[model samples]
Structures are given as C-alpha cells and as structure tokens.
Target: MALLVLVLSAIPRPAHAEIAAWMVFEVGSGEVIDQHEAFRRWYPASLTKLMTAYVAFSAIKQGRITLKSPVMVSAHAAAQPPSKMGLKAGSTLSLDAALKVMLVKSANDISVAVAETIGGSQAGFADVMNKTARELGMRDTHFVNPHGLPASNHYSSVHDMALLSRALLRDFPQYKRLYGYTGVQYGKRLLRSANREYLRRVRGANGLKTGYVCNSGYNVAVSATRGGRTMVAIVFGAASGLERAAKASALIEKGFDGGGVFKSHPKLDNLKRPGSVKGLPPDGYCRRNAKPKLEKLMADYAGSAPMRAANSGLPGVRTAFARESGRTRAAGIATSRADTTIPRTRDKKVDWGVVMDRLIGAQRRSDNLVRITLAIDPNAKRAVPLSAPSADDASKNVADAFGIVMPPRGKPDSRPATQPADTNTNAVPVIVTVPTRASDGTPTPRPAPR
Candidate 1:
C-alpha cells in the first residue's frame, strides 16, 4: 500500500500542469510500470516513420517486394520539408539504403519516396499503414502519411505508440540492428541519426525513435536492455528534445529498478484513450523562447540516476557521404544480404485472400440471384401465386419461390379431401317428391312447369 502510494505520488497526474503524457512498461511481462496521460492523443511527428518501417519490413517478409528493389523518388517525395535527406526527384536507391537514410536521418522526403515505391502512391501506403496498425493492436492510431509530418487526423497516443514499438522490436528481430544506429553513410556526405542523444547518453539504451513538430512538441519511444530485461519508455509533448530525453531516461531507470508501486495496471488494450480531441500544439511550450523554461525542467530531472550515469557527451557516429561526399562509417546496416536466398516465412494460419473471399461471398451470391431474377422473362406466366402462411402454418417450413425447403423432403399431406363435405339433400328431396306426383300428370304439367 505504501509503495503504491509512493508510485502514485511520484508519477504526475493528467491534470498536473502542462506536461505531456508518458508511460513505461516491461517488455516481456506486459506490466505497465507507470503512466501519466498515456492514452491522450498526441501528434507523432517523425515517430510515424516507425509504422512506415514496419509496413516495409512486412512487405519484404511477405515477398511482395525486396530490400534491393529500387525506390524512385518523385517530385512529391522531393518536395517534403527539411529533416529530409535532400533526395532529388527522379533519383532512385535500393529500398535497404532508403530505409537506412529515413531511419537515421528521419528524412521526410525519403519517407514519401519509400511509401510511393512500395504502395504505388502515398494514399495507398497510408491505407496499408492504418490496416497494419490495426493488425498490431494500435487502436488509438490513425495515420494520413508515411512520414510523421503533421496532418489533421494523423495522430497516435503513447499507449498506441508503445504498442507499435513493442511490435516492431518483437516481430522483426532480424531488423533489430536498425534501432541502434546514430546515422547512415551514402557516398561522401555523412548523414546523422536524429536520435543520437539517447543512443549516446543512456546506458543499455539502443533505440527506437524520436520526433518533433510544432504540434507534437518533442516525442520519443525508446527501448533499452539491462541484464536480460528490456523496457520501452514513451514521452510525449515535452518542451524540448532535451526534456524528452531526460524524462525518458528517468523513466527507463525507474523501470530497470522495478520501482513502480502498483503490481499491475490495465493492459494496453484496456487503457483509456482520447475521443476526438485535437493534438496539443507545440507553439506554446516548444517555441524558441520556451527553451529556458524547458531547460530548467530538464535541470530538475538531471539529478536522476539515469541522467547522472548517461554518456550524452559522447561524439555521434559519422558515416560516409551521400550524393557526392567521400564515404563515412555506418553502424548496424543490414547484415542479411538482398542477393542471398530469403526463405519464404509468411504466415500460413491466415490467408488474407481467403478471408476476403469469405467476407464478400454471401453478398456476391445474393447479387447473382438478383441478376438471374432480372434476366428472366418479365411477361412469363407465374408458376405459383404468393400468399401469406396461415396462423397455425406459420411455424411450419414453406418452400421458397425456387421450391427450396429447409429439408429436401417435405411432410406428406395425410388429411382426407372429403372429410368436411356433406350432401345437401333436404331441399332436393322435397322437389323430387313433387316431381313423382307430377309424373302422372307430367305430360300436361311438365310443359307449364318448363
């Protein structure tokens, strides 16, 4: 009880000030370590690329495409704003290289480029992202683009983001190395990774991503491993990148130490979520003038063990040039070669085609029935008149227009047809007696009677 109170007190409440939501969870155990407004909707910014990477990875694994496949850059892709790799229109790169550039640089242009290449259009790719997000159980996420650039409905919650982070890490272990890189090299110009702060500073912190935009402030979904345990920490709506990192690092430390008071919290699926609220804008909290305040917030958390032990001062990794500069070193590039034979490992339990066919099969059958009915001669004579069933007969099965019955054989009618009939002889008997009497005189009377 005391421990729960301590944890409850330590964690900020939703109504507390203007701090954004945060959450920490133990990866394997499915225990929610601590949370504050974890399910509130927030703009994901560049963190949207996590889903992009997931979809691409899924495509590669499904054999629909390949890592070495060429991704052509379109004018649309080249036009995305900065935090981009300066990719030009009409240029092309291997999917593997494009992913490296996007993940390390958080390049918006490459994100669009990759989406277009894989989905044939950005709209189509967004559809795939949302469908895949649903499959991964990210109920509170809806994306409008492959890149995390802000759009009206492109938003996700910390719970949803953490679920995605867990899915990416757990589902695609072969790509685990992708999360650790601080940057990637192309030709001559070195490209730096966007998440160098956490990668360099926090012990056991390897990945996964960070994002910022005017609406989203600074956000990150980070995973780290110590001893043998892995934990993911999500921070949203921080005042600055430093604050985001600091808070994440602090939560991660708490997670590793198993310091939460509550024995368990609601599962990710059960967490409360935002309805239709708009995301918080970063202008008020993340603007240039807010740096001092943000820094002061960071100072308070700096004394935490994780921050104190962090190696944030370490120099970032340098990679060789892209588009012209001499080459630099890249950490954690794909070890699995595109040229090597990839084993077919797609799931066998669920055939999407079969599921879709089943969903529409009944409707299609009904449609065919309507078409057949329309194609028949309208003037044709009716085979039988339609009528309502009698009250007692209502409970009985009736043959349809086509004579289909619930059971192939119907019950034989056993009632006698004449059982309700009786001769009406009383009136005719009197007339017969009169005719016998007139028979003698019939010769004369018959004519008058006629």
Candidate 2:
C-alpha cells in the first residue's frame, strides 16, 4: 500500500513535520506578537546581508567607511556568483553605489567588496559581523561570510535576524532609506530587487531584505508601519519567494490587528538559543519533486490578497535561451537568425539574387528578423519598410510548410551554410527527395548528384 503524507518540513521525508520558523515583533512596545520555532538554527542565505549592512552602517557611523568612499572590486570580491553586479575585478564604485547594488540587487560580489573595504578583508569583516551581532543581542547568530552563500558552520534564527533588523533601524535610522527601494538603476539597465511584495504591494511596508538559496528556501526580515505603530516580521524556511513575502505580510497585518501574545519579550540578547543545533538542509523541501506539496501549502496558508499579489509572477523569473538560437547552434548552422529575402523596390518584384546579397550583408546576430528600408528609387524621399519573417516563429512544421525532410544526423551538408534560410520560411524553395522503391517493396537510395 502506498501511503501519501504531506509534511511542511523544511527538511526532507520520513520527517513528516513542520520545518518553518517565524517571529513578529512590535518595535515600539517590544512585544512578541507571534512566533513559531523561532529559536531553531537555519541557513540565513542572503538575509545574511542584513548583518553585513549593519556592520557597514556601524563603520559609516564611526568614520571607518563613508558613503562617498571608494569601493574597489577586488579579485576576491568579484568572484562571488549571481545574484551579483557582474563587476569585473579592479572595477570600482563609490560606497553609495556599492551599497545600492548590494541592497537593491542583493549582489553577492558587491557584498564581498563592502566587507573587504570596511573590515579590511572578508575574514576580518566577518569577525566584525559576529561582534556586532553580539552587541545587538543576536546571540544565536554566527557569521562565517559577509554574503550568505552556503557554509556548514554559518547560521542564524528568526529571532536573531529580527533582532539585527531592529538594531539597523534603531541605530542607523538615517540609512533606513536603503531598504525600501524598488530597484537600483545601473546605467540604462534597471536591476530590480526581490523585495517587491513589501515595496510595491504591501501597505505601509518599508525597510528590510529578502533572501534565498536551495539550502535556505526563502527568508525575509520585514518592517511596516500602520497608524503610527511599526512592526517587524521575520519568516524562514518558506518554500518559495512569494510564500515568504505573503507570510511576512500576513504577520504584519496580524500584528497591527493585535494578534499573537502581547507579553513583553526579552531583549534580543536575553532571548535563549537552542543548545545543540544543525541547519536544515533544503534539498528535500525545495526540489522539483516537492511541487505538489508546495502548491497545496500555497493554496492554504497563503490565501491572502497581498500574498496572492506576491505570487502573481510565480516561477518564470529567470533567463530563457531563444529557441532558434538553440536549434541553429545544434544544427551547426551559424548561431544567428539569417534571412536572404530582398525587399521589393519601385513596384518591381526585385531581383532575388541582388536582394539576397544585400539582406545577407545586413544580417546581425542580435536581430531576430532581416530589415531593409527600400528607397523605392535612389532619390525617393520616403523609404518602404520591409522585414523578414520573425525567427521567433521558427518552430513550425517544416515538412508541412516547406516540404523539406530534416537531414539525418551524420549526413553530408544539406545546403551552403552562408545562404541558409529560416526553415519556417514560406517564400523560399526547399527540395525534398522521395527515395525510389524497388517493385518488391524494398527501398532504393536515390542516385548521388553528379
């Protein structure tokens, strides 16, 4: 018999148990409005950047680093992976710009640069982070790196993270502006932050960070103000980014509605840490096989309007390679969209040979279709607009439309590579051969071209 059980464990199967941890606090009154497994250790992921920012803030306050100071991308700093700024080694930006890239882009490499600039090296900066965490009453936290990449020994809990966020707000109220930005502009490109739920949709939400890795699932520390009261909400081990934001938003609404215990919680330092600890490995919780469980949970606890709003862009948020790019590359044709059809000029069906020459001359790797502006005549004031069929639609049935068989693998070249037309083209002629059959029904190969 097959027994199916759905456990919300942040860890994998046979452990059919809840894996999530969370906390909601009232900043003005120091109340633990709500909490769940808040003391358990979990990987902080890029939420580790919060403490990294805090250390930087402390350094800024103490004159160790200033917003205008030079932030150089070192060989070490430039090596951290995406999500990053893609800064090359030896590149530099002001402390202000680096901070924006780190906070808004959640860039891993810039985080390293900030750590190195202020703490003198990544190791030294981590030392500063731990010391700062202790001072801020985050006893359950440890920092092995400035960016929250996977490390066996590095970890934090919801309580500790919430505490660090409070410290950032209270001690450096001036830098509070950094947390709420929707996106950071880098030249012509807009690098959007993953914290869109709080910044764009959630009412009165402001300031904080979001984080993720397969190991961490999703984590966020968020703060919002309503009717003159501000609240901090921390969520960990969520199955997806939207779920994390939705849960955090729900806690914010609940805190404002006076949900959870109103008893005054201990100061951040006095909050007890679990004696023995191990960070939950997210492989079991975040893998592809867990989608059904994730969907059910999303439908259940995450049914709020704001939560639904957060989930609107569910799961299609990464790079996708162009389809024809893949096919042509594999076909050993040039890795570009190429068309040889020429534009008509002066109401004349222009010479195909002449047009093919000009169209091929104008082909570029970045273009999805061929474009030609025909003067109609050399001295005509207005030009005729003509464009080739889009390569984006290259997936049509070649046999039905072009009547061309896909040449078998390991076969000789089908056509000249330079003059290859899109397989989906209707105007181009494609030759297809029907093998001659013997009268007994055995197939016969066509005669080779002379």
Candidate 3:
C-alpha cells in the first residue's frame, strides 16, 4: 500500500482546468475535430466584435452600406473605454479603415462608431447582432454590445464562435486579409494587432481576434490553413495571453495531425451541446498572485524550450519565461532539445505595461463612464429600454391590431393531443444532470446519478 501510494503521488495532474471552453473544427467539411465544454456560455469579450463586423458585412452586401462609407465617431463612441483608437468625436474614417482598426487594434471606439454608422445607435446595432446570430443558428449567443465591453447578459459559447468564424471565411473570403494584419496605419499612429503574437508564432496562422476582461480571461479565435486544410480554434477563459496562444497552437496541431472527415463524428452544425455543462465564472487568474502557478503549468504543458525561447523577446513575456524555465529545469521535466534560437524582429518595441494597464483599467473606467453617461445623458438611458417588448409581445400586439384573438399565455388547449408519448420498453434511457445556479448566477455543476 505504501509503494502504491508513493507511485500515485508522483504522477502528474493538472492544477486547474484553465481553459473553460474550446473547439476545433475543419473549415471545409464543418467536421468537429475536438472540443471541450463547447456549449457552456461564457463572456465573448472582443470576440463580440467579430459579430459586429459580420453585421456590417451583411449590410454592405445588401447595399445598405459600402466599404467607402464614412464612419464618424460620436461622444457616445468616444466615451468607450480603452483598447481604442482614441479618435475624438466628429472624427471620421472610411468604413474600410474602421474595419481594419477595429479588428487589429480591437478598438472599442471604432466598434461603436461603426455600430452607430450602420445601425443608427448602439442598441439598434445590438438588435441587428441578435438577429444575425439567430440567422446563423448561434443559439447559445447573445450580444448586448458591439465592442464586447463587459456587460450583463452578453455571452457566447465556443461552438457559436467557431460557427461565426467559419461563416466569416465562407461568406467574405475577400476580407480574409483583415484578420491577418500585423498592424494598421491610421493618420499618424500605427496601431498593432492584438493577435500579432499568434500570427508570428503559429505556423499557417492567419486571421481572427483576441479578447480580455476581468470576467473573461484571455480569449482567442484563431484560423489557420496548412496543406490546403483550414482549421478554426476558439478558446475561452485561458489564464494568460501566452497560455491562450500555446493551447490554441496545440489544438491546431492536433487537428492537422488526427483530424479529418471522421464518418462517425458529427458535423459542426449537428454537434449537440452537453446537457449538464455549466458556464465558467471569472477566476481572476491573470491577477499577480496567481501568476506563478499558472506560469509553471504553462511551461509544463508547452514542453518545448524552443517555443518559449522563440517568444522570450516579446514585450512583457521574457520575465515570465525566465522564471518558468528555471522552475521547469528544477523539476527535471525534459523539454525538446530543438533549436533555442530567438527570432529577431525589426518592428518597434512595444511597451506592454501601458497596454496591460489600459486593459486592466477598462472595467473601472467603463463603470464610471456608464454611471456618468446615464446621469447626464437621458438619451443613453432611453436607448435600451428595460421593459421593451419582446418578439412574442410584438406578435400579440400585431394580432390585436388586426382584431384577431390570440391564445392566452400558458393556457392548455381543449383539443385532443395529436401524438402519443413514447412508451417503448426496449429503449435505452439517457440521464442528464442539470446544473444549478448560485445566487450570483454562475452555474454550479451537479454530480450525475449512477
């Protein structure tokens, strides 16, 4: 018993499930390659901008707007928190420039500017977004804002994001260049892409987006093509940007290695959501106190010194790798003996501290801005009415306008049932455990019955 206990203690185990939800699917066939907790709703962060872009694309396709259309910033848009272009109210950029800045810089201001230009108001744009989500069969997603600044009731699943990514590639292949940009040049400043690191490190990586907020840890939607095979990987709630990139890289490699049209595996559209999976709450894993353990976990899982060495020169990344590599060596975990040569870059150095400070400060700034806006701007408060009529209510209203009597809500019909309940004794019974909700609204996982 002592010997068995000692062996078990020596075995490795993950400290935490750092990635809350993920999915990898083949673009050509829509075949699901691999997925984990794919259906559980989680914060979309800036990935919400993808949908915002999609709606804009649809409007352009319908001749309601054009790429050359001018998008002007408003006080409301300029008031948006950071990760922005810092454009002042009344400043205008062409729709094309707006898309480039929004996707590359993940600009909150540009997102709202585009929303206002195309949809008239932020709330109006949100209605269009929700409609587009339904049209695309993204049942688990709801968008309350365009820029994905933290908001209650805004959520998406990896499954839905993968679908959105695939849709963008399929519908607007011409815009593929937008996602792959390293940086976009505005009048005086060249704004770098948030996804530049992934594009540089991952082979065949091209387009997509990255997002972060206190509620949602680092999130990325990456699409890559190799040997004529394209794969899309969506990861939500990773502990850090580095870990998010590494996990995405791993999943993409796995997909290319073992993924294809598996006849038994369901297509992306047909893949069912796991009934009992619960959405993850914010873990605040990016906080200073949590870095050591998470960094060590990243080093162990990465298993490649070259990978770490190659990225060591990135702004704010070298220190993390330095500490993590030391611990990795002390633990005697063998890493690949491949080349440790650090790649050189001629691009200007980035001050990662300022970037991270802006991101971290956004939540507080946004909260304050919201309170101030609501107090001073009565129009903003009226923009999104809390008691606005739903689709069902609208339908009933239409019926009443035509003097038609609609059935009362939840009233059982007097008519006989058309179909009988299934009574087959030989059928296998599948049990699903429903997760309960905590007082804070986070889903609490329940144990399954035997």
lDDT of each: 0.64, 0.63, 0.68
lDDT of 3 by residue, 55-88 (tens): 8888888777677666767655765789998766
Model 1, residue 165: displacement in angstroms?
Answer: 0.4
lDDT of 1 by residue, 1-450 (tens): 999999999975333135578998888876777888876788889999999999988888777667666666665576678898775455667677777777777889899878866775677788889999899888779999998887878989888898998888888878877777876766566677656656765667768888988777888899888777898999888766656766787788777767646455666556655565445454434543244342254235533433223223334532211111222223122222211111121543433222211111101111000000012233432211112224222212111111233333446656698676456666443211222222222211111121
Who wins the TM-score comparison? 3
At residue 116, give the lDDT of candidate 3. Answer: 71
Query: Candidate 1 at residue 64, lDDT?
Result: 63
Pairs in clash, predicted candidate 2: 10-19
Lowest lDDT block of 10, candidate 1: 365-374
For residues 1-450, what per-residue lDDT tens digits would candidate 2 score against the true structure? 123333443345442234479988888777777788788888898999988888877777666656666666665565577899876655667777777778877999899878766776666678778888888777678989988998877989888888887878878889877888877766666778787545655556676998888777778888887677888999887765645665777787667766535445554445555676555654544553232243344344332433222222336432211113113122122212322223344446544322212211111122111111111232312111111212221212112222345544355667788976557756655455433432333333221242
Q: Which rank order by lDDT, best down to worst?
A: 3, 1, 2
Residue-level error in angstroms, candidate 1, position 205: 1.4
